[model samples]
Target: MSLRTSFAAHRRTRARLREERAFERLLARAPTVESAHELRALATRR
Candidate 1:
């Protein structure tokens, strides 16, 4: 509820969004078959 905690949470959210966007871009740049394989591997690993 404090201003400092709220600001920190906002920053964390922004960082997560940026990371997700970058990961999407990474996957977008990969070749189709390779991307599919990589995504599957990541899914199982998760």
Candidate 2:
């Protein structure tokens, strides 16, 4: 594989990890049942 392709894959993996962390934080700090349900729906979309 090319260097450029590997770089692109790494970037995508980083972005996905960032998004997962953000979602985890959201779940941990979620205030209400309704909001938690909403977050579940959001996560399910992916």
Estimated TM-score per prediction?
0.74, 0.79
- Per-residue lDDT of 1-46 in model 2, one digit per residue for the tens? 9999999999999999999899889988999989999998988998
Error of 1 at 26 (Å): 0.4
Candidate 1 TM-score versus the reference: 0.74
Please, what are the lDDT tens digits per residue for candidate 1 over residues 1-46? 9999999999999998997788777777778977767875795676
Error of 2 at 38 (Å): 2.7
Root-mean-square deviation (CA) per prediction:
2.3, 1.5
Q: Against the hidden true structure, what lDDT does model 1 obtain?
A: 0.82
Which one wins on lDDT? 2
Q: Which sections of candidate 1 miss by over 4 Å?
A: 43-46
Worst 10 residues of 2 by lDDT: 19-28
- Candidate lDDT scores, in order, read 0.82, 0.93
